[model samples]
Every structure is written in structure tokens, then in C-alpha cells.
Target: MSDLHELRIERHIAAPVDVVWRAWVDHQAEWFCPRPWRASVEVSELRPGGRSVVVMHGPAGEEMRHEGVYLEVVTGERIVSTDAFTAGWRPAGPFLVRIDEFAADGAGTRYAAVARHWTAEARDQHAAMGFEAGWGAAADQLEEVVRRLVAGG
Candidate 1:
């Protein structure tokens, strides 16, 4: 795919990698979507070829379900998931592969998300669908969740 088929967003979270990772995997429902849109994970298996299903509920009670499989999972470091395939290597309609990385940065963690689309047109469509604003807002919410968790909330 071309470079235009990828979208990336990074954030410096004021928490450790473990803290951030926990928020990502354990507390995803708390911060997965931007405000006014809640996310619920119907299934989550943090291992290669594992299945994951998440539903995002909008303010107006609209729901969008995303189903995918984990391509790679590394504790406290990285997670790669894709909608291009499901568990057991079953082929599915192509959407995007998302890579989430976390690492130590100063006393905090540096987190990044890279979303790769199958086609540049899809990437552009995602961007037009608020990829930057929506994802960026979700990341900010994630940082808040991690910070609160680390603070013993």
C-alpha cells in the first residue's frame, strides 16, 4: 500500500507503559471512543489469531460493531489487529490493520497508533470520517483513564 493509505497518531501519556497498556487492554471500555460515544468490548482475546468484537454506541443510541482478530500481541509493548481476517485465519472483508505501540518516554509513556488501510481511497475516506479528530480525542481520553488509574482511582 502507499503511504497515503496509512494514518498515524501519537501521544505522550503521563503514565508508565504498563499503566497505559492496562488501560488499553483492561479498561478499553472507559476510553476507547471519544466523549458521547461509549465503547463496549463483546469479546477480547489478547493473543495471535484471537477474536475481538467491540461495539461503539453513539449519543443518539446508534451502534456500530467492529469485529477483528489479533495479528500480534506483545505484553506492555505492542498490539496489532486487523479486520482483514478473523480467527482461524478466515478471510474477511478488508478494512484496516491497527498497530498500537507503547514504550517508556522519560517518566511517562509514548503511545502511538498506526492505522493501515487496504486502499488509499479507504484511507482518505477514513480521514474524511474524522480519523484524526476522533482517534485523537480517544487517545486523549485514554491518557486520562491511565492517569486516573495510576493515581489509584
Candidate 2:
């Protein structure tokens, strides 16, 4: 994947890995998008070849549904999914493969979300689509969710 065009958001959050992972996988709807935007998860099986469907709702009453299949999954550690194929191995227009990783960093967590594009053009398209700003904001939201999880909510 080194040669693939990539975009990523990395953070050293002041929260435990368990809390971060829980917030990301278990509490996705609460923090999957930036403020003013919301996400609805239709299917999140968290296993290899499982379904991963999420519909993002924009503040302007727009909805963008992302449907994909999980390529690999390692609970509390890594998740790799791609929209190139949906559940049941049906092909679709490919864009990028999303990889999410979490690791313990002392008492905190090291988190990274990466998007590997099929081509430079696709990568540029995603960049132009506000990937950095949008993803960064979502990461901030994830931290907020982590806070709630840590506080036993």
C-alpha cells in the first residue's frame, strides 16, 4: 500500500485504547462525522467480509451513503474495508480502501484513519472534497465520544 495514494488522520488521544476503540466501533453514530453532520450506521458487523454501511447526513439535508465490505478486522486494533465491493462480493465503482488502526500509547491511544486511493486522480478528488478538514473534525468528535465512554456513560 506504500505506492498507493493516501490520505490520513492521525491522533495521539489522551484516552485509553479500549475507550477509543469502543467509541469508534460501538458508538459510531455519536461521533462518526463532524459537528453539524450526523451518521447512521445500517450495518457494522466488525468481522472479515462483514458489512459496513453508513449513511452520512449533511447539515443541508443531504445524505451520502457509504456501502462497503470489511476486508479485514482485528478487534480493538485494526479494521480495513473497501467500497470496491459490497456484501456478497458484488463489485462497485472503486474509490478507496479505508484502514483504521488503534494502539496503546502509554495510558492514551494512538489512532490513525487512512484512505488509500486507487489512483492519484481519485486521491486528488477526495482531497478536493475536503477530506482533511472533514476527517479532522470527525476525529475531534471521536475524542468527545471517548470522553463520555471513559466517564462511564
With a 3 Å backbone cut-off (N, CA, C), the pairs that clash in candidate 2 are none
List TM-score per model, in order: 0.95, 0.95
For 14-66, candidate 2 gives per-residue lDDT tens digits of: 99888899899888888888879899999998889999899999999999999
Our model 2 lands, by Cα RMSD against the true structure, at 1.3
The positional error of residue 134 in candidate 2, measured at the CA in angstroms, is 0.6
Q: Flag regions of model 2 displaced more than 4 Å.
A: none
Cα error, residue 35 of model 2, in Å, equals 2.1
Candidate lDDT scores, in order, read: 0.91, 0.91
| Candidate 1 lDDT (Cα, 0 to 1) | 0.91
